[model samples]
Target chain A: MTLFPRAVNETTSRELRKTFRSPSEIFYPLIFFVLVLTMFPFSIPPVPGLFNSIASGILWTAALLAISLSLETLFKADYSSGALEVIHLSGANLVLVAIGKSLGHWIISGLPIALLAFPIGWALDLNFLTLWVLVITLMLGSATMSLTGSSISALTVGLRGGGFLLVMLSLPFFVPLLIFGSSAATNASLGIVPEAELYFLGGMFVLSLTVAPWATAHAIKIRLG
Target chain B: MSKPILEVTNISLSRAQKLVVRDLSFSVSGGEILRLSGSNGSGKTTILRALAGLILPDNGKVARLEEKLGNITTSSNSVIYIAHRHGLEENLSPLENLNFLSQVCTPPPIRDGVSVLETLGLKTSMHVPTARLSAGQKQRISLARLLMFDAPLWLLDEPFTALDTSSKKQLESMIDAHLDRKGAVVLATHQRFNCKSHVLKHSLPMIP
Candidate 1:
């Protein structure tokens, strides 16, 4: 008990460093997010009002998808090397470990990209307040996405077809978050107000908090068996 | 001098709706060495997992020393089970591996990790990552865990697979020392060990 949270924190930080040290992996997704968002302004009609109207939606979905890109790496190495077994056997609360692992993953793939999206948002002619709001919203939203995606990834770590299976299984989950997040962004663009979407997003985040770690832990046990 | 360290009664396990072990029962008193001998898929690994409480048995009982053993009661960190897979981080050296395990687990008093490696016959290459070690070296490192875990019960699956003759004899001596201290060992091995007096052997049939 004296050492558990420290251990969890240490493990999370270690995972963060490991992921960030590899520059190729870090920048590729961020660049992909930018490039995908850039494609949007050209594809749709060239009115700033129209672009801004759905721009928040596009950016939010892009942020959500970007977080999903690196989910496989969350537990694949640990699970493969028998580290998970040692953790499971150590009498540590597996839920805390699950949460730590999920958080570690968010640090690696979600946080930085969301932070950097601010300048990118400004370049898209997004309202300054909306851009700041979008940045904060994606930071919170994508971190949640990364955490949930990691749990899903851990659940399918060694299973055959785990890659496609993760997407197929987790997309339904992402829909509600996507709808609410983008709608909030969309509402911001049209000045439709933000409080209701914020409340809904908060509710979803809380719901995922209650459910995802437990689901991930159960999946790990099944995969371990 | 004391009660048995472990007790199992009428334990059965089924994986994926197929019975792997049925009505299997065994007990190891303090300082006794029990070897589970069976052909592949005879529930040797299954039994070890059940004893460690890593797997729940549908119809059985297991009691560990100072532990109220059951499906959920297994959160205790006292017993250690090393699987056929060895449960090691192959990227780390023997010392590094032990250090990592010690951080996460309650370790036996071996002082330093390398001293435990010395006991396992790890030589100059002892400091190299386990990926550089031969299969036998890795096996020794895996077994070296016994030197670091003060736990009385050892649930080892095929601890002798890649061991050399001298290493195997060292293992025998270690078992002797553990028994002298009243520590019990539950092992699944195909190798023929020469501890005739202290051993109670159970043969597992492939079909049952």
Candidate 2:
């Protein structure tokens, strides 16, 4: 096999193993996501139509926050511990490393949130078709979030108060994703196909997939310097 | 003497807007050990990083030479750099970390992870998480990369820190063995250690 795929495989597997070993890394964001979704119903009045009407917004917002929370430490540990330097010096392509890290983040954070949104949507009285649309939109939107967040995380890897900085820098980029993802779900709830919103999310995913890893590699280099 | 594997010419490096290395120039060839010695803030690490291609020189060039069909060609895979921080994950075992590193290495590692750990006297603790390992043991695990990868140029930054006497001696011998294979080393350290090769000391003047 060529070097790129092999390097990506090792990096992704290492990332997966590290995530698994630290239960809190996986659980904290997940718990935050669940809690945020769970508390929304209690905070709002007991209007059945209101809950269903706002379910898509609440679920997407929770996912976005949970992802941002998890992204705070995405590159911090690796950068401070010198793992990033070693990998870069080892002749492994940093672009591939970025891809692997984003993939791992999507698996742990994005995938779980997407799957869990189904049950949460059910609890919120969303219909079957809308729940599926929520899951699908989240799967695409969260992966894009992970990609965009990876670059920002690398940019702010070692700065003081970088967590808050990451959330701020990333939030602007995430607005479009949030708009389309929630709109898609909301339209699906109203028996609309939501094709345009889905297409937009898909386009953003492909665009970020192509650009984010390269940007992340450069960001890491700059931070290391 | 073999052709120079690395050359840094008139390189001026600045960290955080202050120049740390000013027009510094050096080169390392096969079977040579270039020791960078200086007091704190003298830019030994900066110079080493410049040589490793991690930091670009504002005024000069850093080049790595490779022999391709009897001609010297510039290449990147010639250097292996070990920074101050041990790159092993806190949660992963030494074996797992080494395995991951080996896979990422361009040319696959000649020596397996287990044998390299055994050579470093870390066989028993290879399965334990690196966070539980003592400083010296963790340092040994980081140094294990020397034996695993066959990169011709090794750039080590403060590699002697936290290493016990025996481990330091072992590292010196490893340097000797690597020199025996006609490989070059550019090391930055404060500790005194002996190697069989003729060591060239380059002191970076403290930036005022």
lDDT of 2 by residue, A1-225 (tens): 255487677777888898788787677878999888888878999976887788899999999999988897678788888988877777667888898899888889899989999987898789888999999999999999999899999999989888999999999999999999999998999999899999999999999999999999889878876
DockQ score for candidate 1: 0.31
Q: In CAPRI terms, where does candidate 1 land?
A: acceptable
lDDT of 1 by residue, B1-208 (tens): 5767888888888877878888887788877989998888888888888888777788878888877565543332467677776556555567766665555443324456778887677857666867778888887877766777677787878888888899888888888887888888898988887663469889887764
Which tens-of-lDDT digit does each residue in A40-67 have in candidate 1?
A: 8789888757876677788887776766
Error (Å) of candidate 2 at residue B138 is 0.8
Ten contiguous residues minimizing lDDT sum, candidate 2 chain A: A1-10
Model 1 misplaced regions, further than 4 Å: A1-4, A17-53, A190-193, A222-225, B75-77, B89-100, B106-137, B164-169, B193-197
On TM-score, the leading prediction is: 2
Instruction: Show pairs that collide, candidate 2.
Output: none
List TM-scores for all candidates, in order. 0.84, 0.93
What is the C-alpha local distance difference test score of each model?
0.74, 0.85
On residues B111-152, what C-alpha lDDT tens digit does candidate 2 reach at each position? 999999999999899899888999989888988878887788
